[model samples]
Target: MPAFIPDILAAIAMVGVAYNLAGAALAGRWRDTPAKRPAATPSITMLKPLYGPEPELAVKLSGFLDQDYDGPIAMVCGVSRADDPALAAVPATARTVIDPARHGSNAKVSNLINMMREVDGEIVILSDSDMSVPRDYAARIAAALEEPGVGAVTLLYSGRGETNGWSRMAAAGISWGFLPSVMVGLATGLAKPCMGSTIAMRRETLDAIGGFERFRDLLADDNAIGMAVRELGLQVVVPAPIVTHSCTETSLAALAAHELRWNATVRMLDPAGYAGSIVTYPLVWGLIAWIAGACWWVPFVALLARLALAERIDVITGRRTAPLWWLPARDLLSFGLYVGAFFTRRVDWRGAQLHMARDGRMTAEPETRYP
Candidate 1:
């Protein structure tokens, strides 16, 4: 390697450290001012698509049913298979839809299509089964939609570990790594994210977007929905309240596969931005620069910067999912997964292997091998 390479690496690491500090500052101010509650609360139907039974499934689902909103709120939990054990956990107060119909490669979207037939409320909310929201979640979402020209509302999410050590590590990645990056992107106006954590829209907006059928084959279905809404000359807004996403990975392999799928989906959606995201891993780059004969304190400075950012996120989210000592290992593991995502487009989803096309469409295949 050239002697100048060490200097270049060190410079990049310094920039990454700066980014970490900037992200921390941005996160402190990222949340929007709480939207005032509308005078009238419209009826809401929350569409929760579940797969197999996960850790704390019952507890998470119960949170949605016990909301503080006064309007008539209903939850529709859908499963593609009749025999899926997750059905047992669905609250008796909520309606359950067991549909085995295969609409496209994405099973979750198919579940939503079936659940939609049973939706009776004027407002529709599509939230993943793994998420748990606060009592005011419905009120906040309903108010955001009532804003002028707002097509949809999505919530930012922090992570919660419900299972084991692996789950905590996964949670740390979301709270410390992913969440900060999202904050930076939003602060800079660089990302338009419509996450599945919570997608609240009126019935007419859902109909305008073709009613979930158009997203049946897309891997990043949430983003596709947001894009379609944007095309209609309306904004998809992210409100102040951050929900909780339960991390249930019990093994290293499961965690790796889940994050790799996420990384690959982001890469496919925005290749250039994903490539530039290398700067998000300052500790990894700092260590590489130190090994290449940069200043001895470079890696230590990176570690401190990362820790500062983690502390900021914890303070903002109001809970720390993993110990601070575990951050280095989590960061290294995340960096490895980031590199691995480029080698293949194959991703694991609910015990199925799917190949992603450049156009973001996914095709399901036999479980022959793992990436």
Candidate 2:
């Protein structure tokens, strides 16, 4: 390697550490203050799109129904198959739609399109199947939407790993890698992400954006929905009070495959921003610095900065998803996945092989798509 390579690598590592420290400061400033509940609550239709059985599916599903809202709650759930294990977990109070309607390549969007027909509430909230929210989730969502110029409300979600080691690693990836990146983006006004953790919007707002059908072919459908909302001159707001997403991938392969797809999706949405995020991994850059002949103390300081960033995230999220010893491995794994994402436009989603275009549209392989 060139003599200057070590110096360059060490400098990059220092930049990454500074970037993480900035993110930590931003997260502290953006801490969520509790929203006062609206005096008049609008009835809400919670749309849950399910594929198969997941760990703690029942508890997660019920979290939506057992909300503390005063308005009538319509929990409408859709499944591609009647035999889906998720069907058994659906509360009897919820209106279950087992429709095999393949509206487009995105099955989740198709399910939302189907479930929308039976919606009975003035406000519609679309959340993924694996999230667990608080009892006052409905109230907070309602209050957030009532804000002027806010077209949609999306919440941040922390990861909840199951008993398995791989599951914990996946959770760490979320709490450590994904969550801080979002906080940094939010603070810098670089990212306007609409997560599947929870998307609360009025029915009229949904219609104005052309509904779920508009995103039927998009891979990053949640962000696409946010874009549509923004096109109508509306803001997609991300509030505090993070939800919980079950991280139950039992194997490293499963975890890597899932995160690779996520990284690819973000890359498609904002290539420049995604490229700039390379500086978010101090540990990876730190290793490169050491290998390139940087002083040992340089890597040591970088590692300490990475740990401090992780601890800050844990404090913000109120969950210790990644242990102190696990930070280096988690950061390296995330950096590797980020690099790998650029080489492939294909993703494995719920056992389906999906081909993504540069425009973010997705099409599943015939052999892998559910019938």
Candidate 3:
């Protein structure tokens, strides 16, 4: 059994090589758009779903209000109550809706659905309250949203840090680990992801999927929405990745709570795909071989594999240099989270407790008003 370990390592190295090669191609293809003044500006509605004010919330809110687009933009913010501290300094053009009405276990989508009634524009760009983007955000979204045969357009994000060690790790996990993986999928035509960070679809197409109301109970509502759009034979396009979110988990527990739920959600949504993700972690597998003292080749290949992915991701996302050694630490932690995911069948989101089933829908434990 110990002698065969090198064989396993070599096979795992193959997965690593495939991703790095694909990531290199993806990086080359991941072009950044020059800030072109839009030829013509179309009316746009920025749909924002809010729970409460998070760290740097005000600054994030300002990104949308400060856009340079030549189109009429309506900022629609919704809260579960009349006074979600998030309401304090929202600019006037931004409309606010207060509705405690729970549409389902997915509160964010519920909030978005309530706010959707306020939209009056040719293009609808849905972004989360904690997310921030550039001045060209609106114009870029408009171009993608206007494309024929497009159902949705979502952005890829990197971290905006708060100076904590673990938070940076989590952020790196997203920027280096998650973002490039998504880009690789996009380049290979192997993915259709519509993220809450930014999902701009025609108001009409949103209705065709039965709206956000249809995703009220889905755990991976973003992925489900994207799939629904694809079912309609339309592509969910993600052009020139945009920075749209940040990490706020300060403690290890906080990080685990935040990511574990996400892990379980993804596993539930794609069990086979989730199982295949084990190869994404070379450190843990290499450590197993080292602890057993079977083959020196395992650790050597693992180190090479991880560093290659990191380098590829750095170039692809235009993200800065990471402490190369920290990649292994992040990979081990991610592997731990992936293992915990299989055993976790419940999720706690936005102060709401939910039980995850084999399918991707969440059932509230105590049962919320909508569940």
Candidate 4:
């Protein structure tokens, strides 16, 4: 190797460490948008697409049903088959939509298409089955949509491990790694995210975006929806309420596959931004510099920076997902998955193998079952 190579690597690592420190500072400044009830609370229809019985499925779904909002709320849980075990967890108050039809490669979007027929509310909210939110979630969402030029609203999320050790590891990645990065991205005006944690919009806005069918084949359906909403010259806003996403990975393999799929989706959505996210993993780059014969203090500072960011995220979110000592392993594992995402277009989603095209469209392999 050239003698200048170690110097170059160390410089890059130092830059990454600086980025981590900046992210920590940004996280410390984070605040949730105060919940405000709109003067007129429109009727809301929540579409929940379910595949199987995830951990705490009933509890999470019940959180939506017990909202404190005064408006009439109707929730429709969609399942491809009537015999899906997930249906057993649906609350008696929420209606169930059973359709065994495939609209596109994305089963969840297809489920939404079926559930839309039953939607009767002036406002529509689509949330993932694994998320649980606070009592004020509905009121906050409704208030945000009342803002002028707001086409849609999506909530931020924190991770909660609902299963074993591997689940905690997964949650740590989300809360510590993913959450902080998103904060930095939003602050820098580099990200426009519409997550499945909660996507709320008026029925007219949904109709204007051509509904969910336009995103049925896309890998990053939520991002695509946000883009579509933005094309209509309206903003998709993220409010103060942070929903809880239950991480239920039971083993290392399960955790790896799940995160790899997530990283792959992000890469598909914005290849350049995802590639630039290498600076988000300072410890990984610092270790690489150390291996390349850089100074010893490089990796040490990188570790400290990562720890600082993790601590800040925990403080902001008011919850700690894992121990500080577990961060190095989590960061290393995350970096590995980030690298792996670039090498493969195939990802596993709810027990199905999907091939992704450069255009962000997905195709499922033959004989594959979607949950």
Better of 1 and 4 by TM-score: 1
The TM-score obtained by model 2 is 0.96
Q: What residue pairs are clashing in model 4?
A: 33-240
lDDT of 4 by residue, 205-227 (tens): 99999998998998789989999
Cand. 2 Cα-lDDT: 0.86
* Top model number, lDDT: 1
lDDT of 2 by residue, 102-142 (tens): 88888889889988889978899999988998888899889
lDDT of each: 0.90, 0.86, 0.76, 0.87
- TM-score, per-candidate, Cα-based: 0.97, 0.96, 0.91, 0.96
Task: Output candidate 2 Cα RMSD.
Answer: 1.6
Q: How many clashing pairs does model 3 include?
A: 0
Kindly give the stretch of ten consecutive residues in candidate 4 with the minimal lDDT sum: 362-371
Q: Note the residue pairs that clash in candidate 1.
A: none
lDDT per residue, candidate 3, 1-371, as tens digits?
66777666656755765675566566655556676455668788888887765777777887887987888888898888875777875767689888888888788888888888798887788887768888888878777766678888888876545547777777777766677677777776766678878888888888898888898988888888889998999998877745646787788887788889988887787788778877766666677756665467666766776677677666655665457788878887888888999999877786778888776777775433321
TM-score of 4: 0.96
Q: Which residue segments of model 3 deviate by more than 4 Å?
A: 35-39, 293-297, 315-322, 365-371
Give the candidates in order of lDDT, highest first.
1, 4, 2, 3
lDDT of 3 at 19: 71
